[model samples]
Target: MEELINSAKALNAKKLVVLCRLEPGCLGPDGIDHIDAFCQVAERALVNFNADICHWCLAPRLDKSLIEIQYSLAGKVLSRDKAIKFISSFEQDLDVIEERFEDKLTQLINQYIARKR
Candidate 1:
């Protein structure tokens, strides 16, 4: 768990998305306990390193013994341009799922940034 925190800090993660797999024997009972605990770890490290953007995602519905974890770090500025702001903080990603899937995410992203500046 400590290692996970260090990795995020090292990567300069601005946005984090985690995917958990639910299968038998993936984790022990303690692993279940650590889900909430890990959040504390992230918050503390963010404070230590002065991180500006940090978020977490866990398995939607799964028990502890079957869990998969993922951590990602993004150091890029999140643009809020109207045309390409596919994921808004105000709404859930599901709201734009079809639109997001149909569109070329990277293209919208790049064009948005270019126009923003």
Candidate 2:
């Protein structure tokens, strides 16, 4: 994840967005939420870089089902309500998982930039 962030930084990106697929049936540090576990790993990954402009969206299920979308900014986790709003804007009925992921991520990145304004 840090390498990806570094690559984005090298490309002169203003912000970085990461969408993760949580492991199925796994438990997190929070004991029940895999997103929380994913967030911990993400935060640790960002420790070597300036994570202030990074946004993360964690999918509880596989990238296909996308049961939940959890957001983190600058290593700080946002409330599910707030995350839900961001996630909702990008939700659409697209069956192809790869294409849907690419499109949704693009939209989220755009939304992240717009929010900075």
| Window of ten residues with lowest summed lDDT in model 2 | 92-101
The most accurate candidate by lDDT is 2
Give the lowest summed-lDDT range of ten residues in model 1. 18-27
Clashing pairs in 2: none
RMSD of 1: 16.0
lDDT of each: 0.38, 0.46
Q: Tell me the lDDT of candidate 1.
A: 0.38
Candidate 1 pairs with clashing backbones = 13-73, 13-74, 14-74
Candidate 1, residue 38: the lDDT equals 42
